[model samples]
Target: MSLEVEEARIVIRAGPRRIFGIPTYLNMLGSVKMAPARYLAGVARAEGRPLYAEDPRLRRALEAICSECAAAEAGEGRAVSRAEVVEAYYNALAPQLLSLAPSIDSIVVPCYTGALGEAVARRAEESAPGVALIAVKLGEGGCSWADAVYTAQAVDERLKSLNLGPASLAAISAALKAAEELNLYSTLVVLTDGR
Candidate 1:
């Protein structure tokens, strides 16, 4: 028996707000100093760089920050306002997103039902047309390793079947981070080579 393998290039895009329905805080944060310029520059520098998703130190720090934010937002019985939650999420992700943008072709978020998804989709279309913005359905309950494995497998199958190229896998690692963070149901995202 003989088997043939084909090769093509493709990119995977994913992240908070962009991929996980995390309530975008970038707009809210607004034009602060050289944020746009700085972030753009950062993205350029990161082009073709590897995703930071598997970094133990970064993951721990992100988790710790998210936990702290959740606690703060919880605020005993008061429960901070929705705006506060949005702000907290934004604060936590801005730096990373800006730094990773260049290497990321798109962000795939899981938003079963909410205006957040629509809003993000629109913004991505207008602000960064080159970058793809995808939304998908999320499973009930919490995220788990099983879900991640499933997502990875599905992606691998699609890539292999389509014979996509390395570019397709470019942002896969980063996208996985969003999947793990949001506990996505079915992973889905459309990405272009910025051509």
Candidate 2:
């Protein structure tokens, strides 16, 4: 008998897994359960780096930015001030948020402060554009469910305007649905009456 060597090839096909009938990708960081601050701290610890919030230089810069935001809001009209604050705030936070990109799988604002929510979303976009950013609206104590729903809808609209792909949008929608089903507290309740 004669022995002959033949070339061989191996192929593997992989796709996102389905959860509750929805196809979702594997999130190394797991679900977006941690708050922004907690997530940042975790990332910093994992990387053996100090959180940006702990850096004196960044802290001072953030303070200056906050001051500037307050001045702009006070000097300008509400609408104009909002834009300025959002831009300034987002710009100030982008660096810190970006630093956590390696460890963070997603950013969830939880619909707390309207401006802050927008700023956080913008920061996430600037920091890790590919990462998921979800703004959730849940019922808050003393706040009507309708108000929360409205805020959620507004956030959804804003996120849509960001031009995120279908997957991102779907993720956000699914999160909102989960919140609604669980009757979570509304993070935007405080701002419902125009803050």
Candidate 3:
């Protein structure tokens, strides 16, 4: 069947997925199961590679997202100078997050920094066909709904592997709601700062 040209919309999407896109997911790199900083350090090690920088596959994916660049032109939020730092940091630590994703219906990134998110969102707008962009934010200690457990489960079936949500059932439930509100449907793509 031919792809629907309308259902999709450009989105400044920000969900919780591996640094890399599907290929990383397939390789289990996106897996939350890894030790903290494990993936981060790994990405740092391979900074200037095709997969991290601009591989053919990534170009193809970005091209696909760019194909739908008519809807939202760009993210209309405050910009953060640290975004490049975050992007550079994340890319260096977990370049996988930068991995081009599958053609998405829309994108939901944080409008606060508007740093890398805006650039990427614009790219997403151009990447998909009439895609919708979304933005979100997460505060320190725990104001961010993006880092919620519900978001975790999407990428890591192993979320259930840990006994975290049980104690905070209410919190976990709320996280799920937050995830939904953020338009974190299937394969949500997000960029966050752990620093």
- Candidate 3 error regions (>4 Å): 1-100, 110-112, 139-185, 191-195
Model 1 bad stretches (over 4 Å):
1-76, 112-129, 139-195
Predicted candidate 2, C-alpha RMSD: 17.8
Q: Which candidate is the best by TM-score?
A: 2
Q: Where's the lowest-lDDT run of ten residues in candidate 2?
A: 186-195
Of the two candidates 1 and 3, the one with more favorable lDDT, higher being better, is: 1
Tens digit per residue, CA lDDT, model 1, 39-105: 2223324452212212232223322333222222222222323333223323333333333445455
Per-residue accuracy of model 3 over 1-195 as CA lDDT, tens digit each? 011112221122234411111112122233221322232223333442212212222223322333221112223211212443344434432333324346334333433333434455434444443444433432122223222222222323333332323212222233344445655443333433211
Better of 2 and 3 by lDDT: 2
Q: How does candidate 3 fare on TM-score?
A: 0.31
Supply every candidate's count of residue pairs whose N, Cα or C atoms clash at under 3 angstroms: 10, 5, 39
> In candidate 2, what are the lDDT values of residues 33-98, reduced to their tens digit?
112333333333455434234223223333333322211222231222345444544554444444
lDDT of each: 0.33, 0.35, 0.31
Question: Against the true structure, what is each candidate's TM-score?
Answer: 0.31, 0.32, 0.31
